[model samples]
Target: MSPTFTMSAGRPAPLGATFDGDGVNFAVFSEHARRMVVCLFSDDGKDEIARLDLPERDGDVWHGYISGLRPGQKYGLRAHGPYRPDEGHRFNPHKLLIDPYAKRLTGHPVWNDALMGYRADSSRADLTFDTRDSAPFMPRCVVEDPAFSWGEDIAPRTPAKDTIVYEAHVKGLTWTHPGVDAPGTFLGLASDAMLEHYTKLGITAVELLPAQAFLNDRFLVDRGLTNYWGYQTLGFFAPEPRYLDRGRIAEFQQMVARLHTAGIEVLMDVVYNHTGEGNEMGPTLAFRGLDNASYYRLMPDPRYYVNDTGTGNTVNVDHPMVLRMIMDSLRYWVEVMHVDGFRFDLCSTLGRVGEGGFDRGAAFFDAIRQDPVLTQVKLIAEPWDIGPGGYQLGAFPPPFMEWNDRFRDTVRRFWRNDPGTAPGLADRLTGSATQFDHSGRPATASVNLLTAHDGFTLQDVVSYDRKHNEANGEDGMDGHGENFSHNLGVEGPTDDVSILRARAQRKRNMMATLLLSQGTPMILAGDELGNTQKGNNNAYCQDNEISWIDWSQADDAFLDFTRRMIAFRKAHPILRQKLFLHSRERAIDGLEDLFWRRTDGQPMSSSDWEDPALSCLCVELRTASGTPLYGATETAIFAVFNAGEAERITLPEVPEGMRWVWEVDTTRPDALPGACCGATVQMPADAVAVFVTEVQP
Candidate 1:
C-alpha cells in the first residue's frame, strides 16, 4: 500500500482536474497560453509540492491525464502567456490562477498586495507588473467526487403567475431571529423555524441577495464598513465562506433541501456583470492577474476598463472563455446548490455584441436558451446597466422575466400623489402589457415590484421625501437623489395622530396595489412588518441595526392587516390572470375590462385624471371570459382609494345575485363588515378600501 496515490499523465476531456476513483484527468482552457502547469499545494497552503507542466493541446482546451490523485487534493493553475495590456493580454506566469470551472473552494481570500500580479506602490501600476506567485494568498480549488442522495427533493417549479417572491438576505434574514441561532448562516438559512416563517408568509419563492463569494472593498474595509450587500462577487462557483459552516458545501445543500421540503423555491441574485476588483487602480485579484484582456472589457487604449456596470470593470461576455465561465457558474448553482432560478444583475451586459449594440442572439442568450437544465428553471433579468443602450427591459426572449423598474417608478409616483399619473399607473397595473406583449411572454414576464433591496423600504417611502443616507459615510451622496416619496405632511418621525394614520394608509395602499397587480410581486424582506431604514433609501453599507430585520418592532395591527391582504390576493383569481385584456371594444356594463371611475360612480373622463386634489378613484377589474374561474362567474371588485380627506362615497348598484361585502378597509382593523350596503364604509384620509361582490345563489 503506497502512502502517496499513484501519479501519471492522463487524457483531458473535461476542464479542471477531474479525479475519478481510478485516476485523475486534467484540463485547462487557455487559448493564448504557450504552456500550462498544475500546482499542487500541501495541507498548510504554504508549501508547493510539485509543478507538473501540461503539454497536450487539443483546440483551445489544454488537457492531460494524471493517475492516483485523490479527490481531496488541493490545486491551482499557472498559465504561461504574454503580459501585454495594450493588446488586451495581461497574463502573468508568476501569478497563480483559479480554474474557471472549479467545483469546490476551500477558504476565503485575504487581501494583500502580494496577491497582485503588479506592484501596488509602483507608479506605473499594471504596466510595471510584479512576478510574485499569489498561490499563498488565494484560495485553492478542491476536486471532490460529486455524490449526493437527493431522496425526494425536487424543484417545486411554482408557476410564474402564482409566484410571490420575497427578496431577502441570507445572513440578515436569519441572523437577528432569536430562534435561528446556529444556522442563521448560509448553511443555516433553511432551519425549520426560518423555513416555517417563509412558508407562513405565503411567499412562493425567496430571491436572496448576492451570495457568491465576495470580498469587501479595500476602501470600505479601511472605513470599517464592509460590502454587506455582497454585490461585489469574486467567486461564482463557491458560496461565501462567511456564510458557510466550517468551509463545507454541505451546509448550502442542507439549506436547499429544507427549503424544498417546505415547498419554497430559492432564487439567487447573481452579479456576473462585474467583479469585486474595482478599477484599474484596484488590486489584481483574480481576473486581472489571470487574463485581464480576455476576462474583462478594456478600453481601446487599454489603460482603463469599460465602466458599463457602473462598477469599474464590465466583464467581456463576448469572449468564449469568459462566457463559458458564466455558463459553468450558473450550472453549478442549479445542479449543486439546488437553486430554482437566477435574477441576473445588469443582464443586458451579458447580451452585448462587438457592434456595441445589444444582441438578442448573443452566444450567452443562445446557450441559456438551448441548455436543457437551465431553460427549465426560472430566468429573471435586471434588464439594464449604465452602458450604451443598456435599458433593454422587454428585449429578453420568452421564458425570461425582467425586473420592471417602470412598474416600480410608476407605482411610487401615483401613490405619492403625483399629478396625471393615471395613464402610467394603468399600464403598470396591467403588467406593463405595452412592453411585454410582443415577446410571446405572458403578464408574468414583468416582475412587478414597488420596492427592492436598493431603494427605500415600504415604510420609508411613506415617511421620507428625500434620502437620508448620511449614515453611509458618503455625505448623503451615495444613494439616489430623486426619491419619488411623499412625507404625508411631516418628514421622519411625528407625534401627530393624523400623520400616523396617513402613513399607515399609504403602506396599505402600496402593498395592496402590488399584490393586486397582474405580474408576480416581490416584497422586500422587512416591508411586510413596516420596516424602515430611518428614511435611508440606500443601506448597502449599514450592516448594523439599521439594516437588520427587527422582528420585535412589528405592530400587531399592521401585521394582521398584511396577513389579510396577502390572503385576499391568494384567494382571488382575477388579480393574477396570465393574459392581457384586449383593449378594443369590450366593456362590462359598458365599462372596459378595467375601468377608472370617479367617486360619483361616473366613468373617469380624460380631464378628471388632471385633478390635483382629486385623491379618490375606483378601479373595476374583470376577466376576459367574463368569468374568473370555472365554478365562479366573473365578479368585479371595486377598489376605492381615498388619498384626500375621508368622504363616504355612495356604493354603486349591486348586481343581481351579488351583494358587496367589505373585504379590507385600510383605515379599520382586520374586520369583515357583514352588511354590503348602508355600511357607511368609513375611508380615513389617505386610505383605501376593497369592497368585494361575491355572487350569491
Candidate 2:
C-alpha cells in the first residue's frame, strides 16, 4: 500500500509535474477555470486512487505539492469552467485532461462515446454537453524521474553546409528490416545494423517523422486505417508510447544517445501548429478540455476554429501561456531528450499573429531566435500551410532552412524533358539564390529535396505518371495530381527490359542531380535502396507493406550509386559551398568559380537560357580565390545533363595542365571514376555525366 501524505501549496514558477527528490509539485495553467483537480491513478492507469483540488492559485495557474508522491506516479487534470462552446470556454471537470508538459504518458486512449465532450448524434452538436466520465478512455500522464545516465553523449552538430539529412519514418524504416531484435520500435531504429547503414550511406543526420505522443483519428480507425505519419499530436513533450518497445520513455533517450554515439544527429519533425483535439465538433481530449479559448485560435464569434493548418484548428501561439508551453516543450526535447534539431510541420501557422498574416517578426520566431538553447540548434521549416499567404517557401529568416519544392519540380521537369524548364533548373542547381540569398543566409538555407514524406519515392517518380492512391480508401481522389512524374511508357511495374532500364536510368539521373546541387540535400530514407510505394504518393494511411520499407527488395546497385554520390559530394566541397556561386573569376589562376556552358564547350548565352526547346546544359565548377571556400585548391568539376537524344558533346576547357576524368555516368552500370576521357565525349540520351579535372603534377 502507498503511504498517505499531506498536500501543500506549490510554487507556480516551473509548470507541469516536477519531482524534486522527496515529493512532486504539480502546476497547470487555466485562465478561465473556476477550480482545478489533480487526479492520481494506480500504476496500471486503470484505477483512480486519489483526487485533490489544487490549494493554491497563482494568477491563472493552479499549483499544489504532494509529499508522498514518487516518480512512477500517474496523474491527470480536470478543470471546472463554463461549458460554453460559442464563448470558447470548453471546460468540463468530468473529463480527464492531459498535462501540456507531460514528459511521459501511459496507456492508449480507448475510443468510446464517453471520450467526446459533446453528444455524437445530437443536432445541437458542440452546444450540447455530455456528462459521462472520460477518464476510462483517456491516457494518463506519468510523472517521470527524468534521470538518465547519458555518459559522454555529445551532439554531432554537423555543419549545415556539409549536412545530408535522411528523412525517415521510425516504424517505416525498420518495421520490415530483417534480423532486427525489435522491429518498428525506437530500439530497433537505433540498432547497430541501422547505425552502420546510416554511416555507410554518408548521411550526417536522421530527420525522423513525428515521434511525439499523438492520436489515431477515430475516422481513420473506423475506416480501418491508422495515422502512420503521426501528424496529430497529443502531448508535445512525451514520446509516442506505441513506438516504445517496453512502453518506457527512457527508450527514446537511449535511442538518441546511441544515435549520437554513432556521430549522427537526430532531428525531430514536430507539429506545434495544431493539436489532435481539432475543431469544435472534434473531441476534447486535452487542450480543448483544459482551456479551449487560450490554446486554440477561435473565430470572431468564438464558436468555430481558424483552420490555418488545414487540419481543423490552429494553435493560438499568440497567447502568452500557449507560447510558453511550446517553448518549454522544445527545451525539454533538447535538454532532456538530447535531440539536435527540429523540422517544423506546417510552420507558417506558428508565425501567424491574431487577425493579421504570417509575420517574420511573430512572437514564436522571436522567442526561438532569442532562446539560449534553440538558437544554437538546427531549425528547419516546412514553411507553408493551407491558410492565406501560406506558400512562403524562401521567406524564412536566417538559421532556418526551408524545403524548396521549386527545386523538386524543376529537377523533375528537367529530367522529364519538359520545355521551358532549363532556366528554372539552372536557378535550382545553383541553390535558388534569388529566394534564400537575402538576410545573410547562405545556399544551405535552401533544403533542396526531390521527394519528401508526402510525395512519391524516387523510383515511383520515374515509374508512375500519376498517383495510385486507391488503397488509401478515398476512391483515389486524394494525393497530388501534378506530381511532375513520367511513366516512361508503362503505368506500373513491368518485366519489359527496355522500360525497366529506362526507369532505372531516370532514377539515377535525378539522384545525381539532387546530390550535385549546391544546397542542403535531404534523401528520403528508402530512396537510396530504391524503395517504392507502388505509386501511392500519399501513403499516410497505408501502414502496411505499402508504407513499411522492404529490406528484402533492396537494390544493391542503386544503393552503391547513392553511397558514391554522397561520398563524392562530401569529397568535393565545391558542390556544397556556403555562399552562392557566381560566374566571375575569383582565383588568381583566372578560373571562374561557377559558369554554365553549352554542349559545344562554349559559355551559355542569354538566348540559350531563354530557349524554350533547350533540353541540355553543362555546369562547371572550379577553384576560386575571392574568399577561401571549403574545398582544396586547384580543383575543377564539370557536369553535363542531356535530356535530349544521344549526341556528341565537346568537353569544357580544363585548367593549365589538367585532364578530365569521368567520375560519374548515369548511362553506365557502375559510376566509378574511370580513365581520362578525350576532348569530346559521347553523351547518352536522358542521362547525366560528371567529370573531375586532375592536374598532371
The best candidate by TM-score is: 2
Error of 1 at 372 (Å): 2.2
Q: What's the TM-score of each model vs. the native?
A: 0.93, 0.97
- What local distance difference test score does each model get? 0.78, 0.89
**Model 2 steric clash total:** 1
Q: Model 2, 1-697: lDDT tens per residue?
A: 2346567998896899999988999899988988988999987888988888889999889999998689888999988999998898888887899998888888567789888888887997789888999999999999988888999999999999999999999999998888776888899999988999999999999999999999998888989999999999999999998889997888999999999999999999999999988788888788998889999999998999999998899999999999999999999999988999999999888988888888988999999999999988999999899999988988888778999999999999999999999889888989998898798899999999999999899989988999999888899888999999999998989998999899889989999999999999999999998899999999998889999989999989999989999998998888998978878754445656887988888899999888999998888886566333443333778888889998788887766677888888998857457568899999889988888877655
Residue 559, model 2: lDDT of 95
Model 2 poorest 10 in a row by lDDT: 625-634
Per-residue error (Å), model 2, residue 503: 0.7
